[model samples]
Target chain A: MSVHVAPLKTYIYVFLALMFFTVLTVGVAFVNFAHHAPKGIGNVLNDAVAMSIALTKAVLVVAFFMHVKGSTKITPVVIWGTLIFMVILFVFTGADYLTRPMTTFVPVMSQ
Target chain B: MSENSTLAHHFDSYAQQKESASLGMWVFISQEIMFFGGLFLAYTIYRWRFPEAFAYSSNELDIGLGLFNTIVLIGSSLTMALAVRNAALGEKNGTVRNLILTMLLGSVFLVVKGFEYAHKWQHHLIPGPNFQFSGPDPVHAQLFFVLYFSMTGLHALHMIVGLGILAWLTAQAAKGRFTPENHNYVEGVGLYWHFVDIIWIFLFPLLYLFGRHHLT
Candidate 1:
């Protein structure tokens, strides 16, 4: 009985939990991180915090709804193949986007 | 005389057919995730360069609607899962009922999303010539809305496809084509539905509601 099939009902709880965290993360973001920062570090801190929670919610979805948790060897192997392929794609595309300079005309600069 | 040879003649048992179906569906899902990964990475890079623009623009999105859609999608995912379970357990009527519910919920998601997009379009919140964003970085703001439209619009397309599949599956269920012994088709579609929900889970917060509170 190690299959440990995920039940449909449990997803309700997961959904609620993600909601709670999303709201909480958003709420925390509005607390004026500058007040807690040295000078201009507040925005960075706030972004970091918000991203952390966002990442957590993403992980929850991957693990649960996708049912990747407690998966077998073959399933993980297939997933790894997909992950590796996606990584290659991301790296190449990112290289292109990164190398290209922002060439759009800036209104203020043009003025 | 036992002619349920929707199974390939080479395959001996229905279990193999079911397993293959599951594996194939998973591969499809992996491809989908990778497709979305492109946009996710784009979002990441843009946010990295224009953190302030991204943060400020997010403030304009309706977080409450975003939250509502998230819950609705999750609820539909649950129904999709139940549909699969019912199919796998040889409950034809239950499977059809659940698939119907799932499809209905999907339609609702599209309706809500349509309203949101129309709102943006009407207000010229979209990011082209005549776009109206007073943010410090209009380009960055436009980038967010671009990502927003591309991502959610693609997701909405998937939901439409998923709804079509569910309708067909419901028809098959009504005909008693599915049995507890062979319902991988239902399970496979269920996986797709769940994947769609999972995407929304990230998107609800990321594309729409993220960083909104920070600006407030």
Candidate 2:
């Protein structure tokens, strides 16, 4: 059987997935898995969860709304061109944040 | 319109014209993503330094409103897509109706968001100048509010612009300007509107709903 798909159906699928994501995000937020998890998990689990959810949503938006899903080579190339520059920017700036030498001022204790 | 003298007399054919317009809009959307990327980066750095405070500040935000707004924007995005589809199918009336719905939905988002901001302002929830909420580390709390406002405020501005485009498109549709062979505006506007929705998708959880348990 030759199966045919409509664009609206695809959009509806995406919309439902987004609704699911909303629940997942809210639920993940209430869970005590992050470093600051309402005094529960002492690790960075919560942060990890939050970041993961965010990344998923970002990917979905880019793939669908931007029409990168089932896209041709030329379009992907254009998107990647911009992404390359963005990545380069993030790299240098992020490295600066992590590598800055911290000097403890420690108010001089005068005898 | 025939391909000989009807392809806008500019492009080789209608298909080429449509593809080029879509490509151009995609490029514009990429730049927008990068624009918001800057704020998200700042938010990450600050969140790392003051995780607890970010969590605290996030909880105070109305998560329900944020979630609801997400739905509204998503629905608008769909309507925008329908506008493009109608334009491609030579359905002038469908295009106008869809554009109106899309634009109205965008306005609803702004109105709802305005109410939220008003509530925040009344509570002195905005960062700086008598930020009333106190409980968590005050400095970190303030950082959260700063990020919240910057992210959401920029989003609201985009919504306003999207409404403008939608309005223009609605007017053009009323004049019967779009048909199967001519819907560049509809396609372009759809791409822009969808991009705005995408930005909010990322911002919603990051700004309004993250780090929940920690605060309560």
Best by DockQ: 1
Model 2 chain B, poorest ten-residue lDDT window?
B1-10
Off by over 4 Å in 2: A1-5, A34-44, A61-66, A101-111, B1-6
lDDT of 2 by residue, A1-111 (tens): 121113667767776787788778887777776444465455577556766876786677667655667556777888788789778777877888778853422212211
lDDT of 2 by residue, B94-128 (tens): 88998899988899899999999999899888766
lDDT of 1 by residue, B1-216 (tens): 277646667777776666677778888888898889988888877877777788778887887778777767877876777777677667788898988998888888899999999999987888677678877887668788888899998999999998888889899899998877677678788888888887886776576655665645
Task: Note the Cα lDDT for every prediction shown.
Answer: 0.76, 0.76
Q: In model 1, how large is the Cα lDDT of residue A5?
A: 46
DockQ for each of the predicted structures, in order?
0.35, 0.32
Model 1 clashing-pair count: 0
Off by over 4 Å in 1: A1-71, A89-111
